[model samples]
Each structure stands twice: as C-alpha cells, then as structure tokens.
Target: MAWGRIQTADGRTLSGMLTDTGLQPMTGFGSTTPAGPVEALDGATLLAPCQPGKFIGLWNNYHAAAEKNGLAIPAAPLWFLKPDTSVVGHGATVTLPPQAGRVIFEGELGVVIGTPCRNASLAEAEAAIFGYTCINDLTSLDILNADPAFAQWSRAKGFDGFGVIGPSIATGLDWRDLTIRTLVNGRERQSYPASDMIFSPAEIVQHLSQDMTLMPGDVIAVGTSLGVRPVKAGDVVAVEIDGIGSAEVTLA
Candidate 1:
C-alpha cells in the first residue's frame, strides 16, 4: 500500500491510502488540514508523504559514494537533522532563496519510522519501519562546504522546500534488492543498488536509536551517491526507486 497527504479542491489537507480504487481517508490523522471523505487522486494536490517530527539524515552511507570520494565508512551511522518545514512534495516548484545561493539535489531513499523507538535492538528495527519513500534532499552547497569554522550542514540543508519527499510511501517492499536512480532533465546521473549501502536501514536505526529517540513519522534519508549535480530554475529532477514510486520536482 501507498500513503500520501494531499490538499483537496475544497482547500483541506488529508492523509489517505491510495488503493486500487481511490484515496481513502485515514482516521486520527494529524496534518496541515482536517480529515475528510475519500477523493480521486486527480482531485487533490499531493504533498510530502511524511510530516516528520524529526528528519534525520545520513552521511557516507553509500559505499560507492564513499569510495569515489576516498572516504571510509565510519564505525557507525553519521547523522544530521533537517527541520520538518523543509519538506515539499513531488511536482512542486522549488523556489531558490537568494540567501541560500546555489543548491544541488541529492536524490536519496528515505526510511519512515512507524513506531516510537529508543535504543531499539537491530532485530526490532525492521518492525519499527513504516515504509520507504524518495527524497531529493536539496542542499545549499555554497553555505555548507564554504564555512571555515563549521560545515553548517544543518542550516545549509533546512531551507524551506529544501527537502523534497514524495509521491507516496511504499509499504512492504524488499529494500535490499531495490535500485535507486536519479535523473536530471531526463539524463541519468546516479544509479546504485541498495546493496551498495555501507550500512543497512535496520543497522542505521539500531545505531541512531542508541543515541536518540525516534518517533513515528520521523524520516531518515539514506545518503545519496556521487553523481549529485546542481539544478537551476526550470530544471526537473526525478528520483526513481525500483519498488517505491518516483518523486519529481521542478526548480523555479
């Protein structure tokens, strides 16, 4: 099953499951809008699949990317946080903030936490996952790598619409065999199998939980590969994961 949040024609936002039939309202859903009846997929504007309480991101998680840069995999998952407000849906135009400077897209696979977990064991981590989704993880490269004192990755990554997540969460899929590909204006840039990850999702959760609490709806973006490139106004980026659907966005 796939799940998404959308704004209806009536100007209300809802969380629903996309069935073979249509969108069905989810109970007790908390989002930018109130719950409502089922609607056609064509009747609503799809938003990011998650309203993350905490958006955790990984660095050097992909073996290929790490090797390409001549960096070694750390002893554990290296993590950072992106604020929830940065999330934008697929197909939405990403406006470049003058202060942010030039931004680049880091297409990645996102893991959605299904249940609250603190210090979860490796064996239990899989059960805690809700599903997987696609994330662009746009970054302001200028501010990020330029700072001499600090990398400022957090600030460089949390600008509004800097985190692109969508079109829906893919549930019950075999992630290990999945392939992640990134395309810029229809030109393939990055392609890698999930097997190339230095750390698996379960291992990542187990490691992260040892230090912090992971709440339901929290997101973890498994790091992207080495083929990341800059995108400008009018450019379209598409991230395609084998089982999880593609997420596309346009830079404006």
Candidate 2:
C-alpha cells in the first residue's frame, strides 16, 4: 500500500492511501480508519508524504561509489541531518539561495519510521519501519567545500526545499531489488541498484537507533551513488524508485 498527504482543491489537506482511482482519505498516518471521501488525483496537490521530525541522510553507504572514490567502508553509518524547513513535496520548486553557487541533485531511497525506537535490535528496527520513498538530497557543493577547516554537511544541504521527498511512501517493498534513477531535464544522469548499498536499510535503522530515538515519521535518506551533478535554474530533476514512485523538483 502507498500512503500520501495531499491538498484538495478546496484547500484542505488530507492524509490518505493512494489508489489507481484516487486518494482515499484516512483518519491518520498508518491508520486503517477512513476519514472523508475519496479525492481525485487530478484535482489535488501532493504534499511530502510525511512530515519528519528528524530528517537524516547517510554518506558513502554504497559500495560501488565507495570503490570508485577509493574510500574505505565505514564500520557504521556516517550521517547528517536536514532541517524540517528544508523539506518540500513532489512537484515543488526548489529555489536556489543567492549564496549557493552550484547546486547538485542526489537521487536516494528514503526509509520512513512507523514506530518510535531507541537502541533497537535489528528485528525491532525492521518492525518499526513504515515504508520507503524517493528523495532528492540537493546540495550546495560550493558552500560545502568553502571552508577547508570544516565540512558543513548540514548547512550545505539544509536550504529550503533541499530535502525533497515523496509522491507516496510504499510499504511491503522488496527494497533490495529496487533501483534508483535520476533524470535532469529528461536525460538520465544516474541509475544505480539498491543492492550496492554497504549498509542495508534495516541495519541503518538498528545502528542509528542506538545513537538517538527515532520517532514516527522520521526519515532516513539512504544516500546516493555516483553520477550526481549540478543543476541550474529551470532544470527539472526527478528521482525515481520503481516501487516507491518518483519525486520531481524544478529548480528556480
């Protein structure tokens, strides 16, 4: 099943399940109770699938990319956080801040938490997972490397609209078989298999949970592979994961 949040034509926001016919309104996230009537997709605006309290992004989680860059695999997840304000839904416009010189798009898979977890075991973490979604972790590369003394991972990627995620969150997906593809202005820029990930989604959740409590609606971006490149104003960047669906953002 796929879950999503959307704005109806009447300007009402609803949480619902996405179906071929339309969105069937639900009482709440992960709830089986119906709230309102089914809404047609054509008349509704899709919002970010979930509002995450903590938005985490992993680094160098893919073996292929690690090998290509000659970086050793880490024993644990190397991560960063993106502010909630940086999040935007599918079809949203990402404005390039004046301070940003070169902005790049990273296509990644997002793991959404369903239940609160702290120091969870692997089995517990697996059970706590809600689903997966697509994410475009936009970065201001220029700002990232500006100061040699420190790598500003958070500041470099936490600009408004930089944490792009969701058309829907897909449950029961075989994430290992999924592939993440990125396109810039209709041309394919990245195509990588999730099998290349050095740390699987479940392992990431278990390990990270040991560090901090992961609440419901928290999201973890499973990092990107090679082929990430800069995008300019007017460019439309799309991140697609077969079962999870695609999220497109236009640069402004």
Candidate 3:
C-alpha cells in the first residue's frame, strides 16, 4: 500500500493511505489505530509523505559515481544532515536563493524510517523501514567548495526547499530491485540501478543506527549516481523511482 499526506481546503494536513479508489483516511501515520471516511484523490494537493525529524543524505554511496570521481570506498556510510526546513513536497516551487550560486539536482532514492532505532542489527533495520520515497537532493555546488578550510555541506545544501521528497511512500519494495531516473526540463538526465550501491538500504540504516538514534519519520536519501547537473530558473527536475512515484520540483 502507498501512504501520503494531503492539504485540505481548510489549510490543514491529513495523512492517509492512497488506494486505487481514493484516499482511505487514517487516524495517524504508521499506525493501525483507526480510519476516517474515504476522500477522492482527484484534486488533493500532496505534501511530502512524512514530516521528517532528520533529513540525512549520503555521499559516494554508489559505486559508479565513486569510481568516476576517483573516491575511495569507505568503510561505512559518509553522510550529512539537511535541516528539516529544507524539505519541500512534490510539485512544490523552490526559489533558489541568490546566495546559493549554482545549484545542482541530485536524483536519489529515499528510505523512510518507521520506528525508533539505535544500534539495530541488519534484520532489525530492515524491519524498521516504513517505506520508500523519491528524493532530489538539491545542492549548492558553488558554496560547497567555496570555503577552503571546511566543506560547507549543511549550509550549502540546507536552504529551504533543497531537500525534495515524496509524492507518496510505497511499502513492500525491495531496494535492490528498484531503479532511479532523473529528468531535467523533460529530458532524461540520470538512469541508474540501485544494485550499484556500495551499501544497501538496510546496511545504511544499521550503520547509521550505531552512531545515532533514528526516529520515526526520519529520511535517509540513499545518494545519487551519475548525471547530476546544474539547474536554473524555470527548470523542472524530477526524480522517479518505479515503486515510489515521482517528486518534481521547479527552480524559480
């Protein structure tokens, strides 16, 4: 089943399951508590599948990108955090700040955590996943390298609307079986298989758990492969994963 959140006409947000017929309203996300009446899906505005407490992004996780850039395979995942404020829902418009300089769109798959996890085993990590979502890890390429003393990872990537996530969350997908494709201005820009990853989704979670506690609704972007490029005003960049659906953001 797929889960999503929609904005009501009254300016409130409602979480529910996306059914073929319509949306089956649920009392809360990731729970079997109860449900409300079914609503038509025709014109509802979609929000990011969940409000993530932590927006984590991985770097050099894919072997293809790593080999191309001559980066060494790391013993564990190399990651950075983007503040939750950077998140924008599917179809949202992102105003690229002037200070951002040149920004690039990184299409990647997303893993959404369902339960609290810390020091979890591989088996437990797999069980803790709620579902998957599409991600566009928009980054300020210039700012990232502008500083000589330190890499401004968070500052370069944490601007509002940089962390693009979700049209919906799809459950029961095998990460290895999925492929991520990116389109920029309606042209195919990236296509890669999840099987190219140096670390699998469960392993990513298991490793991260050993370092920090992961909370429900937290998102971990599995990282992008090749074809990451700069996007300017009026450009539409979309990241689509077969099971999870597309998350498109416009630069303005």
> Regarding lDDT, does 2 or 3 come out ahead?
2
Better of 1 and 2 by lDDT: 2
Tens digits of per-residue lDDT for model 2, 25-67: 8887877799888889888899999999999999999999999
- Model 3 misplacement above 4 A: none
How many angstroms is residue 142 displaced in model 1 relative to the true structure, after the best TM-score fit? 0.8
lDDT of 3 by residue, 78-127 (tens): 99999999999999999999999999999999999999999999999999
Each prediction's total of clashing residue pairs, residues at least 3 apart in sequence or on different chains, is 0, 0, 0
Order by TM-score, highest first: 2, 3, 1
Provide the lDDT at 226 for model 2: 94
For each candidate in turn, the TM-score is 0.94, 0.98, 0.97
Q: Give per-residue lDDT, candidate 2, residue 69.
A: 97
Error of 3 at 3 (Å): 0.8
lDDT agreement of model 3 with the native: 0.91
Candidate 2 wrongly placed segments (more than 4 Å): none
Q: What is the C-alpha lDDT of each candidate?
A: 0.85, 0.94, 0.91
